[model samples]
Target: MTEIYFNLLGNSRESYRKNLILKFLEEKAGSGTGELSSKYIYYVETTATGKKIYLLRPANLNKGMDFTVHLKDVQFRLIGPFKDRPTHSEIIQDLILKKEENNLEYEKVKPLINKLFLCQAVSDEEYRNLHFSKGIEIEGILKIIKWLFIEQDITYWNFSGRKMLYESLRINNLV
Candidate 1:
């Protein structure tokens, strides 16, 4: 089981906080057991307990604007054996469609989109195709823009969207 929290600061000035924590974990955890680098997602596994975790953080700010965000929590239990841990795609799908049925409008959706882009789950060509599709609406475009600018704030870290996606992978033992 994992508990996740999204503490939104006034606008997005504190966005770097997320990076700080992730970097700390990565350095302590050591090389390659699943990293959340600037261009890749982070994956964690506990050798003894055989537990796994993933995490992602996306932030947005408007100079002086104030905003609030939803804090998310997830719990995962071993259904059978440790060897049969859920696949990454399965976990992501579950996270995406969980109770938040209205996630399409949630502020976090933008960051998720950016994470997906880094994962190549949705390519630029696919994005353009979707954007031009007849059924797409203006609101959708606005949503895309909202994610593109604010969600990818870590571009300055030279970590690209992949790092953000890696952070998205976490198992919240705290919950």
Candidate 2:
């Protein structure tokens, strides 16, 4: 079973994602530790037997990878993973319906449209500009950027996006 919670910060300047998770586990449940990073994340579940760590890593699948984003106010977040089912298609379906209904507001759907929610943040700010890894896969990252070129109409540069993409890949040794 997976339970996801969404905390919409009234002030966009203040974000406590990791802290909040830790606090919830410690106070609401019991005392334990959770490690959050771009590469891996683990949360310890406390019980009578002691602590149990549940590790979460990226899914390296061709499709049906759960990347359910919670959009509220000025926030974009992935709740939690389910058995093997994700909400990617469901959310995309929702977006399509909203677009057809003329209710696809850019800011509200910016997380999905720009694909920012797909990347992990390495900084401590709300809007972490330095994305961990583009999309779930490096190649998929470029594809999403290409999609953004059409969706967001990035008219300035032709090769800038690709250049940056390659630079990021090289830095991460993903190429």
Candidate 3:
């Protein structure tokens, strides 16, 4: 079975986080088995602010699978800014009513919807459900970011260590 790993940090101004992560991943990628290849690693920066995001997936996984992972990761990273971000219900409502009108698939959209709910990022909910464990919440967010990037065909560069993942997050409407 394929496994995913994530390391999340609170806001930090340090410039080396992306490079540090890239070096660590490159070392693992060089192992050549039971780990993602360097080619499968993708780095995306927000178009406006330049906050960076990193994505890793096994070479063998399908594009659809990879896309889901990217979305989860992006959602997780976005949670820090909100007193609580949009809830799963609110996101789903928007997707179904608006985003789907633009031709996005509901199945492809459900995971992100669920993730937003679980993360307590949705500020619209009147009563919060704190049922999900912290570990599950983190995993869900990582998976979402992975999926979103793949689906959106977001531009990503190879692991360069020179660019930080946070830079990607700083850009555009992605946050």
Best by TM-score: 3
Higher-ranked by lDDT: 1 or 2: 1
lDDT of each: 0.32, 0.29, 0.33
Q: Model 3 reaches what TM-score against the true structure?
A: 0.26
lDDT by residue (tens digit), candidate 1, 18-68 = 543445344323333235322222332121122223333221222111111
Model 3: weakest 10-residue lDDT segment is 123-132
Q: What is the C-alpha RMSD of each candidate to the true structure, in Å?
A: 16.2, 16.0, 14.1
Q: Which stretch of 10 consecutive residues in model 2 shows the poorest summed lDDT?
A: 63-72
lDDT of 1 at 150: 34
Model 1, position 73, has a per-residue lDDT of 22
TM-score of candidate 2 on Cα atoms, chains taken together:
0.24
Off by over 4 Å in 2: 1-10, 27-86, 103-175
lDDT tens per residue, model 2, 6-59 = 232221111323333343353222133333312223332221222222323232
- Encode model 3's per-residue lDDT on 132-160: one tens digit a residue: 22222322333333334233322232443
- Give the Cα RMSD of candidate 3: 14.1
Residue 71 lDDT in model 2? Answer: 18
